[model samples]
Target: MTTRTDSDHDFLASARRTLDLEQQALAALAARLDASFEHACRLILACHGRVVVTGIGKSGHIARKLAATLASTGTPAFFVHAGEASHGDLGMVVESDLVLALSNSGETAEITALLPLFKRLGTRLIAMTGHSGSTLARHADAHLDVSVEREACPLDLAPTSSTTASLALGDALAIALLEARDFSPEEFALSHPGGTLGKRLLLKVADLMHTGAELPLVNHGTSLRDALIEMTRKGHGFTCIVDAEGRLSGIYTDGDLRRTIDHHGDVRRLTIDEVMTFGGLTIEADTLAAEAIRVMEQHRVTTLVVVDTEQRPQGILKMHDLLRSGIV
Candidate 1:
């Protein structure tokens, strides 16, 4: 007696409810995490060989992500399809390897087919499944229970709530392994040097600075007349004020000379120090080029003296220097 319109409306309501229910299930899974996760982390930490991930159907989707996270964060890993393992890919699993298997029912046939072989090869099988007493869990070296109280599916059939729990559990394993190794950001940068974080952590300020004669610099006691010529010659809009030791004493810009002329109006008589901004913005030669931009923006200036540990002027950085590097 129900109309087609009523059935369509029911289907939409059921789909929305499935998503909401599964989202809460994943939150609960994280809340229940404990020492078993530490045990999983230890297994991965001690692994000298690769993590061979295997799963069937929907579980395979989560398995691929787990393998990628593990490889990117310090643990070497790759995915092996469960069905393909029976045909020939089982050769990829070495005796020293760890096998992470995912199956919501704990009874996927393709996964179970490789159990005896994995056990015989001495591969430690780690199971992510909903059933504890299932065959896969029974044979696992470490069984991670991804069980759910109820399926988000109205008929309790589709893999909604169970899959969400499995995905979260996989994330927990990746992060735990990531911290267990004390993986530094520098190490991560080597793997992803083209990205922003990689560029900041791996590249130095010296790599982006204008060095040698490219620097806009003036000698001590130079007249404001000669300093203006140096600033224009270098085209960096400012000139460095250096002591006799080549140590940075101050900085003079077009802005500084303009302010001086507004008050004194005698460029002919003013010395470099007399009109220069005292101890103007400077950064270490080893500082990040990205941080250098913040220095320029914060001071509302365009130039900075790049100094060494001994406070000697080594180079200069202009806003355009950072701009040319595409970091601005």
Candidate 2:
């Protein structure tokens, strides 16, 4: 007959203890970083072939995630289940490949069984384990100790803190290799084309802009009524006013039209040059679409004129275009 309050208190206390244990384990792993860690990074960096990550059970799950992180961050990598490797899956490992093996006890029979074959194939091995003196660590070209003092589980048998420590160490390795290769956001985007980050990084102004006949354009000497007609036809909420040389000189929007009628009381009496905003915000066609959003937000404008190096209007970009394309 435990009370509801007591049950709630116990639940919260268990959660806090679990988090604290995992945090302390990560701190210990960080302090243990030494020449072995550097050597592991160098081996992965200099690897001629892909990094093949292998493990069993919970360690296998961490190995898969680490492989994915390494591949997406610039290093070529893939995961192979250790139990499957002794079968025909060992063909996936080659002479030039680097093997990253993970195990808490450092004595996974499935992984250890392949050590002899790996040696014969001349494959390089890097082991991450809790036991530094284990067979896997002793046979590895480099060893990273992801040892944890104790598990966060009350029974102290589950792989809670150990798995977290191993995952964090794997992330450190991926990011270090990423920086070493000068991997850019653009390259990362290429690896993740279906993601939001890819859309933001790969989308250029030219890709989203309305070009040619889609552009709302009028000559500087055109009447305000004619500019309004052009803007209506293009549905961009604005019209670009070009000089005699066919270069962008100014812009006029619906806001300008409203202000003109309020101030002058006669839209027919004013020309585009007389009412248009001079030297309006413009962006190069090759600019990133994310940068275009920043410019529009900063100036409080809904439209941007895409121009070339010669300042000639090539197309127009509207807020709706960005919103429709998910660039916003």
Who wins the lDDT comparison? 2
For candidate 1, what is the TM-score?
Answer: 0.86
Question: Which pairs clash (backbone N, Cα, C closer than 3 Å) in model 2?
Answer: none
TM-score of each: 0.86, 0.95
Using TM-score as the measure, which candidate wins?
Answer: 2
User: Each candidate: what lDDT?
Assistant: 0.85, 0.93
Candidate 2 lDDT over residue span 103-154, tens digit each: 9999999999999999999999999999999999999999999999999988
Q: What digit string (tens of lDDT, one per residue) describes model 1 on residues 131-201?
A: 88999999988889898988897788888799888888898888878887899987887877787777877
- lDDT of candidate 2 at residue 312, scale 0 to 100: 94
Q: Given candidate 2, what's the lDDT at residue 115?
A: 93
Off by over 4 Å in 2: 1-9
The alpha-carbon lDDT assigned to residue 77 of candidate 1 equals 95
Clashes of each: 0, 0
